[model samples]
Target: MLRDIDPILSPDLLHALRAMGHGDEIVIADANFPAEGLGPRCIRADGSSASDMLRAALSVLPLDTFVPDPAHSMAVVDDPDAIPEAVADFQRIIDDTADHPARIAPLERFAFYERAASAFAVIQTGERRLYGNIILKKGVIAP
Candidate 1:
């Protein structure tokens, strides 16, 4: 167990985060997310909640400042404006953890799936909440 690192972040997850370059994206998906079917490297964090996984990831991964929205979450079907509890938690985590003030924008259902499929990796969490999935773009660490 590495000091200062969240225990929930397994070795595989840490490797993926470290390997990602600026602009590369990673998905922290809910239990319902078809992580395996969507492709990309899938890392299972089945015992962790989406929020827990998000917080752990953000602790080390910097959000892309070049893009307006470095973080994104799946929108509720037919009610894109609605913020689910899990998504609210995500926003809170981002607000608290990000080096910059990053807000999580909502992505259309299919659009989110497409983005997740193209992500550098997907961390599938055991969060049971609907629409708990989030995508984070990696950013450069300033010298």
Candidate 2:
């Protein structure tokens, strides 16, 4: 086991994260998310909460500062303003980990799926919360 690495990060997830370059995006999806159908490389993190996986990912993954919003969550269907409990947890996780806490941009259901399709990879979690899916854009480590 690697010291300081979040144990929740499986070898596949770590490889995907390492393979991704700056500006590339990764999706952390809920159980309900149609991850396989979306077409990006998929990693199964079943039996784990999206929040847990998200935190683990944030531990190693740097957020894209070049973009105004590096974090994004799917908007509640028919109620874009309503934030899911999971999304709130995501916001807190991002705020705690990022050097500059970026707001979680809300995307409509279809739009979110469209974006996920182009992500470098999708980490599907067992989280049952509605709107638990979030996308994170990778950033470079400063020299």
Tell me, by lDDT, which candidate is best: 1
Structural similarity to truth (TM-score) of each candidate:
0.98, 0.97
Against the true structure, candidate 1 reaches a TM-score of: 0.98
Q: Candidate 1, residues 1-143: lDDT per residue as tens digits?
A: 99999999999999999999999999999999999999899999999999999999989999999999999999999999999999999998888888885888999999999999999999999999999999999999999
Runs in model 2 deviating more than 4 A are: none
Residue pairs whose backbone atoms clash in candidate 1? none
RMSD of each: 0.6, 0.8
For 1-143, candidate 2 gives per-residue lDDT tens digits of 89999998999999999999999999999999999988899999997899999999999999999999899899888899999999999999988976667999999889988999999999999999888899999998999
